[model samples]
Target chain A: MKETWKELPIGCIIEEGGTSRKFKTGDWRSERAIFSKEKCTNCLLCYIYCPDDSIIMKNDKVVGIDYDFCKGCGICAKICKAKAIEMKPER
Target chain B: MPMKALTGNEAMAEAMRQINPDVVAAYPITPATEVVQLFANFVADGRVDTEFVAVESEHSALSACIGAAAAGGRVMTSTSSQGLALMHEMLYIAAALRLPIVICGINRSLSAPINIHCDHSDTMGSRESGWMHIFAEESQEAYDSIFQAIKIAERAYLPMIVSTDGFIISHCMQRIDMLEDKEVQDFIGECKPHHSLLLTDKPYTVGPLSLQDYYFEHKRQEIEAMMQVAPIIDEVGKEFGDKFGRHYGLFEEYKLDDADNIIMAAGSAAGTAKVAVDEARDKGIKAGLLRIRVMRPFPYKQIQKVLKDKMIISVLDRSDSMSTMGGPLFIETRAALYDTETHPPICDYIYGLGGREIDVENILSVFEKGEIYKKKGVEKKLAFIGVRE
Candidate 1:
C-alpha cells in the first residue's frame, strides 16, 4: 500500500536531500544513448556535456552511459565531436 | 494598558515592532506603505533586530519571505491592491509550503481605471489561496488582530492576511489600548520552528516537483490544515481576549436574538452597519448586525445557527464578483443558510467600491427596506448602494 498524505512530510517538504538518485529521472526517456567505443577518442567531451551527468567514467576515461539519470536529451551525442555517443529509440 | 492614537497602518507597524520577526521582505504600496516604512525605521534605529529587505516588487517580496520562512525564521510583509495581485503566485507557494508568515494586508480596490481606494477586492480575490483571513473594522482591531494572527499562523503553519480597509482605516486615527513590548512578547512567546534549511545534520527539500503520483496527497494535507485552522483561531482569540481584555470570536453578532431583520457585513462597513442597527432599533425596528471577523475558515455552522428563524436578511459586500450572482460574502452567506429550516430572503448589496462614501443613513435605508421585508419575506434582490446606475 502507498503512504497516505498524513504519513508524508508536511508542506510538501521531503525530509531528505540528494533524492534524485533514488527517484531516477530516466524512465520518461523516449530515446537512449549508446556508446560506440571504436570511434571514441575518450576526449571527455561527452562526460562534460551530458545534461543529466549520466556519462560513466572509470579513472578519468569514459567507459559507458549510466542510463539511470539520462533522459536521452541527445546533448551528449551532439556535443561528442568524436561521434562516440549515438541516440536510438528506447523500444 | 495605555491607549495610543494610531492609524491602521501605524497599529500594524507597532505590532511588528512588538513581534520583531527575524526577517521582513516587502514592497510598499498605497495605504500599506506606512506599515513597512515604519518597520524599516525601527530596524534603522536599531530598536528591533529585524532584517528588512527592500525588495524590488511584490513578487520578489513574497518570494524572499518564503525563502526566509523555510530557513527557520519568523517572517512578515505588507502590501495592497496591485501589489497583492502581483504576489498571487507566491501566495499559493507560501501556503503550500506552510510558512506561517503574517501579512498586514491593507484592503484596496484593484485597478481597471486605476483607482486607489477602500474595497475588499484585494483580499477577497485571494480567498482561495490557502491563507487565513482576519478582517478588521478599525484601528483597534487592526492593532489587536496582528498579535493573534502571529500565534494562529505559527500554530497552524499557514500563512495569514490580517486586513484593514484601504484609506478608511489605514489613514484615520483611532485610540487603541496597547500592551507594552514585554506584555506583547509574553503574549506571543519565543518563535520555535520545527524545520529549517540550515539544519544540515537532518536535511530537507522544499517545493519539490510533485506530479500526478503524489501531488494529490500534498493538497489533501493543505485541505485538512485549512479546516483545522478554525478551532485554532477560536482558541487564540479567546486567549488574546483574556490577556488583553478584548474578546474576539469567529464572528461578532450584535443584537441577533429577538430580532427579525439582520444585516451581515465585514471590514469597516460593519462598523457603519452597527450604528444603522442601533438607529433602526431606536425607532422600534428589530434590526441586528452580523460582523464576520474571519472570512477564511468561514464560520458557516456558527453563522447558520445565528441566522436561523430571522425573517429579513441582507448581506453587504464591499467588492463585487461581477458574476451577477453577488459578492464573496453574499455568496458564502447564502450557501451557509441553504440547509436551514427557515428560508429567509437574503438580499445582496455591493457598496463602497473604490472608496465610495457610505454612512449610517445610507445603511439605515437598507434596514428600513428590511423592515418592509420583515412583515413578509420577499424575493431576494441584488442592489448597489452608491454606484450611479
Candidate 2:
C-alpha cells in the first residue's frame, strides 16, 4: 500500500525544493546574534535576556554575542528598541 | 454549543489565539486590518502569549515571520490586496523553506482601479507559490480551517493560506460555537516541532539557491512532503470532528446526495448558494451545493467521490481568469474531474467580481444558465456577473 501511495499523484506542489537539510539537530541555536557596529545601541536588552548570559558589554557600549553559549532565541532582536541585533546562521 | 456571534476578522484572530502561535508578524491593510488588530489586542490583553511584531511594511511583516519560522517556531501572519502583493517575494520563499507557517488571506480585489471589496485576484496570483490554499464559507469555517491549516502545514512542512471573501465574511458578524481552548490546543499540538531552534546543538540552512544539478531534487522533495499532507489532512479532520463535534472535509456537500444538479463554489458564495439550494429543494428541483474548503493539495480524490453520479456540475468563481478560458478555481475543478470515468458534465461560471452582491436571484440565474447549457449538450461559455461593458 505504501508503494501505491508513493505513486499516487498528490499534485505538482509536493515537488518543490526542500532538499536542503539541516546538518545538526541543534546547530541553528548555536549561532549568536551579531550586532553591526555601525548600527547598535548600548541598550543592553541583549545582555538581559540572552537566556544564557551569552551577551557581554564593555566601556558603556555594545561588545559581542558569545557564540559558544548563545542560543539564538532571537528574543534579543524582538526586544531591541534600536533593532541593532541580527541573527545570522553560524559558520 | 452550536453558534456564537463573530465577524470573519474576529474569528481569524480567535483562531490564532486558540493555536497559540509562537509569533505573529503583521501589518494593517484594508478589510484585513481588523484581523491583525484583533490579534494584537489578544496579545496585549495576555490572552495569547505570541510575540506580535508590528512591522513597518507588509514585506517586513512576512520577512519577520519567515525568520521566526526558520528558527523553528510555529509562526502566523496575514495580509490582503496590496499587502499581499508587497509580500509576494517572501510568500514564495516561505513555501520553499517548508516553514509550516499559516496565513489568513482575507481575499480582496487587487488594485489599479482600487476597489476595497471582495475578490480572489490576490490569492489567485499567488496560486503557484507552493502554499496550500483553504477557502472558508463563513466565520465558523474560517475559525475551524485555521486550526486545520496549522496541523496540515506543520506535518507536511509546507505553508498554508486560509482565505475568506473580504467584506463578505470579514465585515459580517455571526454566532459560531468555538472549540474550547484545551480542545483546540490538543488537536493542533501534534504539530510540535521535531527539532526546533529552542533546543541547541543542531544546525540547518534553509532556502538556499541550488544549481541546476540539485534544483530538481529539492523541488521533488517538497512535492513528496506536500503529497504526504493529503492523508494527514483527512486524519486530522476526522480527529477534530471526534473531539470538537464540528466536521469539515476537503469538499463539503450540501443536499447533493440525491441531486442531479449542483452549484460548486468557494468562500462565502458557497454560503449564499446554501440558502438558494434550500429554496430550490423545496421546489423539487433537486438542486444542491458543493463548497470546496481545501483548495490546494487539490482534494481530487474527495471531489471524485462526492461528485460521482451528478448530471451537471456548475462551478462559480468569484474572480475571473482575465483572458484564460475559464476561472482559476473552475480550471482546477475541471482538471480534477477530467480524468475520472464517472464525472458529470461541467459548467464554469465567473461571478461576484469586485464584490458585486450575489443575491439569491443571481445564484438562481447562474444555475438556470448552466442548466440551459446542459440541456443543449454544448460546452458552457465563460460568464461575467453585473458586468456592463
Candidate 3:
C-alpha cells in the first residue's frame, strides 16, 4: 500500500464496526480443527468454548467447524467432552 | 443592534443565551465562573434549551464537552488559570478528535504565587494544544468573538479558545451592541457535526488506538485542517461584518500606515497601548499599534507585511515564556519577521504579568525605549517593563 497522507482515512475515522470478520485469521493457524459427527454428543460445549464462534450447527445439531472465521486455536478440541473434535496439522 | 452595558462575563453569557448550545459542561472558576453562572441561571429560567452539566472539575468539564461534541451536539464551556491548567490533557484530546467545542478561557495567571488576576499566561500556555486562539481587547470583542468562534469552529472542524483578560476585561463593564436572538440564531445556525458518534447508520469510532501505524497520518490531517483556519477566519469575519457591520481580521492594525515605530501587543493591554500610540501620534512621534487578535496559526505572513516597513517594533507580552529568550508573543513575532527582507529592529518587553497595572505612561515609556533603540542599536534583546528591579 502507498504510504501517504492522501491514502490514509480522513481523521482516522473508521466508518465500519466489527470489520475483523472480513479478515480470515484461519491463515495464521498451523493446525485445523476436524469434527466427527458420529462421535459427537450434542452438548455444544465446543460452541460455548470456541473464541472465534467457528463451531457450526445444522438444524440444531452439531455439524462441523467453519474454518473461514476460525483461527484453529484448538479450544474446541480441548473443550470437547466426547472427543468429537480433533486438531490435525494442516496439509 | 441594541446597546447594553455589560461586563465581559455577562456579554459572553448573553452570547450563549443567543446561541443556546445543546450542551454546556463547565465548572466554576474565578472571573469565568460568572459566565457559566449566568448561563446556568438562563437554563433555570427556561430561557434556553441546554443540558447544563455542572461538572465536578475542569477536567470532567472538558471531558463531557468532548463527549457531547462527539455525539453531534453543540457544546461549550468556560475556565480560567488553574482550571485551564487542569484541562490540559483533555484539551489535546478534544483538538486531536477535531471536535468543534467552543471554550471561553478567561485569561488568568498560573500558580506558584496563586494569583486570580488578569494575564495571558493561561491561554498562552495552551498555544500548541491545536486550538485556534482569539484574544479580545474589551467586553464587546469578547461578546462578538464567541459568535464568530462558533461558526469558525464548526467550519474548520477544530476546537476554539475565545479568551478575555481576567478581571481586566472579564469583570469590567462596557457598552456592548447586542444582536437580537433571532439574528444570532440564524447566523450561528444549527450544529451539523462532520462525524457524530450518534450516527448509528454509519458507525464509527472516536479516540481510537492508532499507535504508530496511522497516528502520524491523522496528525498530518489535523495540521492540514489547521492550515485552512486563516482563510476560514477571514471568510467568517467578512460574513459577520457584512451581516452585523463589525469587521475583524487576523490582527487589528491601528494607525500603522506611515508610522516609524510600532507597539505590538494583545488582549486588554492592546487597548492601553493604543491610547499611548495616539498620544505619540499627536506629538508627531509616528507611533502606531498592532493588536494581534488571533495568536495561533500565528499570522506570520500578515504580520511580516505589516512590520516590514516599520523602523522599530516592540512586542509587549503579558505572560513570560520562561525560555530565557523572551515571552511567547515576542518569540512568535520575532520568528514571523525572520524571513522578511526589511530587517526592522524588533525588541521584546515582558510586561503586565500577574495582573500588574500597566498604565498609559508605562506603554508610552516602551515606545520611548523603542525610539532610543532605533537610534542607538538595541543592547539587550529582551527587557522587563513594570518590574521593581
Candidate 4:
C-alpha cells in the first residue's frame, strides 16, 4: 500500500482554447498525433493528404490539429517517411 | 484476512466474487472452463450477487457482456484460444462502443496443428482490437489484475482484456491472498456509464452505424480513449497497490540496474525470463528481465527508459508476426522506443509459439543465443526456443 493520489477521470480534465470558459469539458475519446519538430521533414504530405481535414496550417508550416474532430486513423504516420509523426493518446 | 489455497481459476472467480459484477458470461473451454465454473459456484452459493449467463459460444459470451456493459451493468467474462478467436467480432464492438467490460483470456496456442497448451498467440492475436490487454505472470497478478481492470476500464470507458498462461497459472495451485470483498467492492465501486442504455429516458443512441460521414470520427474517438487509458492504468494501478499491497504496472523489471542485456517478454514467459536472469546474474552476466504487464498501450516510455542503457535487448515473443521481419511484440516495442535518444539495439526471438514449453533451460539457452545474436545485430528470423523442426 502506498499513498493515494487524487484520481481524476478522463472526462474531468480542463479543456483548452477558450477565452470565456477556462475549464472546458474534456473528451476522453478524442486523440491527435503530435509531430516531433526535430524529426519532421515538412513534406506537407500530412497537410495536403488528411482525410478528415483534422490537420491544419500554422506559421506557413504544417501544424496543429482539432483532435475532437481528428480520428486517429494513423494516416499521417503511415505516410510520414521521416517517421516524425507519433500518435499520442489524448483524453 | 482469510487465506485460501486456490488455483488461478479459483482466484479469478474470487476476484469476480469480490467485484460482485452484474453479469458473468462465459463459454466452457479448456483451461478456462474452470474459471466460469468457479464463478457459477459463487453465484449458486449466493456468496456474490451476479448473473451467471452460460452462453452457447464465445461470441455470445462477449456479445452478452457487451450488452450488459452498455446497459449500465458491470460485466466480466473468461475464455481461451479458440474461444478468444471466436469472440473476435464482439471484441471490436466492445471497444468501439466504449463498454467497460473486462474479460479473462487464458493464454493458449491458436489451433492449427491442434494442441491445447499455453502460448501468447491466443491473446496476441487480439492485441489491436482496441482493448486494453494486461497479462498475469502468476496467480497473484491473475487475481489482483482483474480487480484493477474494472476500475481501469470504467475510468477510460474502454474494454479490458486480462490474460494469464493457460494451465500454468489457470490450473496450478497457488496460495493467493484474496482481497477483502468490501475492499474490492469499494475499490471497483459502481459502474457509471458514460452512455448507458438505462438512461434511455434521455434518448441517446449507444451504437449507431456511422456512415462515411461519422465512422472515421467514431474510430478516432476510440483511439483517443485508448491513449488516455495508458496513464489512467498507471494511476489506478498505483491506487490498487496502495489498497492491496501489489503494484502491477506496464512492466516489472528484475536485475536491470546494472545489466547490459535485457529480455523483453509477456505473460508467464516473464517469470521464465526472471529465472534465466537470475542464473545469468549468478554466472556474472549482466542480464535482466522486462516483464510486460500492459501490452496494448505498449509502455514505450518505460521500455525506452529501462532499456536505454542496455547494450542489447532480446525480445522473446510467443507469437510470430508471421512473415513480418520480426515478432509482433518486437515490432511494437521497437516502435515505442524509436524516437528515444538513448535506446538500445533490439532483436526478437519467437519461442514457445504454438503451446511449446519454455522452461528455465530454454530461457538460459535463449539468453546465451541472444548474446550471440546481439553481436550479429537484428536477424532475419526469430530464434525458436524449445522447438525442433
Candidate 5:
C-alpha cells in the first residue's frame, strides 16, 4: 500500500528533507542497548556518540534510550566511560 | 534563410551562437575543437552573453555544464573522441538529473591505436548513456539539428547530443542555409529547467544517495521521460521546418516507396547510401535508403512501419560491436523488425571503423547483395567492408 514507482518524483531528488524519520530502523536491532541512569556520570558521552541520536535527553540530563531509531549499534554503550549503558540480546 | 559554405564545426558553432545559451562550458578536442573555439571567439567578440568556462579536461567541462544546468541555466558544450570518452561518466548524470544540456559532438574513433579520423565509435560507445542522440548526415543537417536539439532537450527535460561525422562532415566544406539570429532565438526561446537548484525557495536535495529503496523508481521516471521524446522530436522538427522551410522526422526515408531493397544507416554513411540508392535506381534496380536521425528512443514503431513491406534490407554500421555477431545498428535494426509479418531478411555490413572510407562503390555492392538475398536467402548475415585480412 506504499507509493508505486509511478508516483515518485522525476530524478532521485528528495523534495522534503528529514523524510528519513518515516522509516524506523529499530527493526534492524538484533540486540538492543539498555541504559542505566543510577551509575551514570551524566557526562553525555553516550548522547554524543549515539549515531542515531537515540540517547534520550531531558533538559541537559540523560533520560533513557529511544528504541525507535536505534539499530543496536552499541556505539553509545561502548563510548560510555561511566558504564551507564549496556547491550542486551533482543527476544 | 541565407546560403553560405561552411564546415561541419563552423555550422554547429553558428547554431550555438544563434542559440546563445546562458552557459558554454567545454574543453577542446579534435574535430569538435573548432566548434567551441569559434564559440569562444564569439564570446571574445562580445557576440553573445554566455558564461564561457574553458575547463582543463573534458570531464571537468561536462561537470561544469551539469552544475550550470542544475543552477537553472541553458548549458552547451562540445567534445569528440577521447574527450567524449572522458565525459562518458558525467553524460549519464546529466541525463539522469533531467538536465537539458546540449552537446555538439563530432564522431571519432576511440583510441587504442589512436587513429583520429571519423567513426561512430565515440557516440555508439555511449549509446546507453540515456541521452537523446540525433545523428546528422552533413553540415546543413548538423547546423539545423543543433537548434532543434536545444528545443528538444528543454522540451523533454533530457540532455541531447547532436553528432557530425569527424573529418568527413566536420572538416568538409559544404553549403548550408542559415536562419537569421532573431528567428532562431524566437524559435527555441529559452531553457526553463524542470527542477532546478537555483530556481527554488524551498530546499530540495538534487542528487541524493538513491539506493535499493527508490533507485528503480527514479530510473523508471527517466525511462518514462525518454518514451515521451519521439513525439517531442517530431513536433520540434516540424515546427523548425514550418518556420524555416526544412522539415525533420525520426528517420528520413529516401526513395523508399515501391523499393524492393532498403539500406538502413546513420551519419555520413547514410549520406553515401543516398547516392548509391540513386545509382541503383537508375539501373532499374529498386534500392532505398532509410537514414535514422534519432538513435535514442530508437524509432522502432516508425521504422517497423516503413520497413514492413520491403523485400530485403541491409544495415550498414560504422562501428563493430565486437560481439562476433554484427554491428550495433545491425543488432538494433534486426531486433526492431522482430514481429513484422512481412519482414525482409535483414543483414549487416560492418564498415568504416576507424574512419575507413565507405564510398558509393561500397554501398552499391551492399545493394547488389540485397538482390541475391531477396532470391536465394541471406547466407552471410554479417560482412566487413574495406578491411584487409
Candidate 6:
C-alpha cells in the first residue's frame, strides 16, 4: 500500500487484478478448518462454498485447505454433509 | 468564421455538431430540451457520428454518460432544473471518476410551484460537486465555451459543466460567430483519456469502493487536479484567442481600470450590468463590471487583484442562498476577499429569481447603491433588487 499521496495512483484506481491477495487476510482468522480426506465424499461442496477460494482441489477431489488466503469463516465445516471438515480453535 | 443568428440551444447544438463527440446521452427537460433536440436531429441526418441516446429519464441519461465516458468515449449532455436535480448524485460520481464528460446545464430555478425560467439555482446547487463550471453570457460565449470545456475537461481529466441561463440564453436568439467544423476539430484535437476501462491489456476498476483508508488520498488527488485547471483554463483561452481571435479569461473586466465602484456578476445578468456600467460611466460615477466566466476553480487571486483597490463592490447573485447570506456568487466573492489587505466593503444583491426581468434601471440602481456604499460604508450586507417587500 502507498503510504503517501504522491505515491498513490490518480483517483486511487487499482491497476492490478487480485490485489487483495497481497494482504494476508488469513492472519485475521482465530479458527482453522481441518479437512479429513478419508471421511470426505468428494462432493466438492467445501470447494464450491469457500468464500475465499481457500479449498484446495486436485483432480476434482477435495484435498485440503490453503490457509494462506482463508479467514476461517467456517462455511465449509457448516456445509460438509459427511462431517469431514471440522472447525478447530487455533493452537 | 461565419455569423449566424441562432438561439442558445441551437448554438450549443452546432458546437456539438462541430466537435462530433462519441456519445451524447440526454433526456428532455424544459428550456434545455432544444439543445438535445437539435443535436438529435443532427445525429439523425448523419451530419455527425454521435451515438445519441434518448434515455427514459435524466438519471439514466447521466448514468449512461458515465458508462460511455468510462469506456474512453468522449461524451456530452444537456439538462435543466429538475433534470439536473435528478442527476445530482451522478454528477458527483462523474467528477469523482474523473471522466472528461462535458455538460451544458441550462440554469433554472428549483421547485415549490415548479417554475421553468432563467436562474442559477441549478448550477449553484451543484457548486461543490467537484466539476469545473463555466457560465456563458450570450449565444456566442455559449458556443465558444463548449470547445473550451472539452479541452479543459480532458486536460484536467475532470468533468466540466458549461452553464447558460435557461430561457434567457437557451431560448433567446442572438447573432453568433461560429468556427468552422474543421477549425473546431483541429483545435480540440482527439479526446485522449487517462485510465480508460476499455484498455484490455491494462485492466482496472473505476468508481471502486474506497473505504476510509484511501478515500482521503483519492480526494486529495482530485483537489490537485482541480487546482491545476485554473492555469490550464488561461493557457487554453490564450491559445484559443490566438487562433480564433476571441479571447477568454477567468473573468472579464469591463472598464474596471480606475473604477471606484463595481458590480461583479455572472451569466446574462452581466450583459445587463454592462449596459448599466456604461450608463454610470457616462455620468462619471467611475463604475465598472466584472463578469465571472469560470465559476469553479474560482479565480480567487484574480478577483482580489481586480477588486482589492476598489472602494465599494456589489456582487449580483441571481439565486438566493436561502441561508440569508445572499447567494453562491456573493458568498464566494466575500470569501475570496476575506484575506485581502484592502477588505473593501462588499454588498450582495439577490435578484432575477424565477425568470424575473432585470432591466438597465434595476442594475443602475445597484451601481448607485455602490456609490453610496463607497461614501457611507455598507448599510446592508444583503439586499434584494427588484423584489417586493
User: All candidates' TM-scores?
Assistant: 0.98, 0.79, 0.87, 0.79, 0.88, 0.91
Largest DockQ belongs to which candidate?
A: 1
Evaluation by TM-score, superior candidate among 3 and 4: 3
Candidate 3 chain B lDDT trough over 10 residues, lowest sum: B205-214
What lDDT does each candidate get?
0.91, 0.79, 0.90, 0.80, 0.90, 0.90
Worst 10 residues of 5 chain B by lDDT: B195-204
TM-score of chain B of 3: 0.99
Candidate 3 has a DockQ of 0.39
lDDT of 5 by residue, B1-389 (tens): 68999999999999999999999999989989999999999999999999999999999999999999988899999999999999999999999998999999999999888988998989998889999999999899999999999999999999999999999999999999999999998999867777667755865677777778778888889999999999999999999999988899999999998898999999988988999999999978899999999998899989888998888989998888989879888888888899788766899998888888889998999999999989999989999899996
Clashing pairs in 3: none
What is the lDDT, from 0 to 100, of the residue B307 in candidate 3? 94
lDDT of 4 by residue, B285-322 (tens): 78888888998888787788888777778888888878
* Candidate 1 positional error at B48, Å: 0.9
Model 4 misplaced regions, further than 4 Å: A1-91, B373-381
Task: Report the number of clashing residue pairs per model.
Answer: 0, 20, 0, 2, 1, 0
Which pairs clash in model 6? none
- Candidate 2 lDDT tens digits, B335-364: 778778975788777787788888887888
DockQ of each: 0.77, 0.03, 0.39, 0.01, 0.49, 0.46
lDDT of 3 by residue, A1-91 (tens): 3567766655566667766676576787889999999999899999898888888888888888888877879998998889998999988
User: Using DockQ as the measure, what is the rank order of every candidate, best first?
Assistant: 1, 5, 6, 3, 2, 4
Q: Looking at candidate 2, what is the lDDT of residue B62?
A: 91
What does candidate 5's lDDT look like per residue over A38-66, in tens digits?
98889998888888888889989999988
TM-score of chain B of 5: 0.98
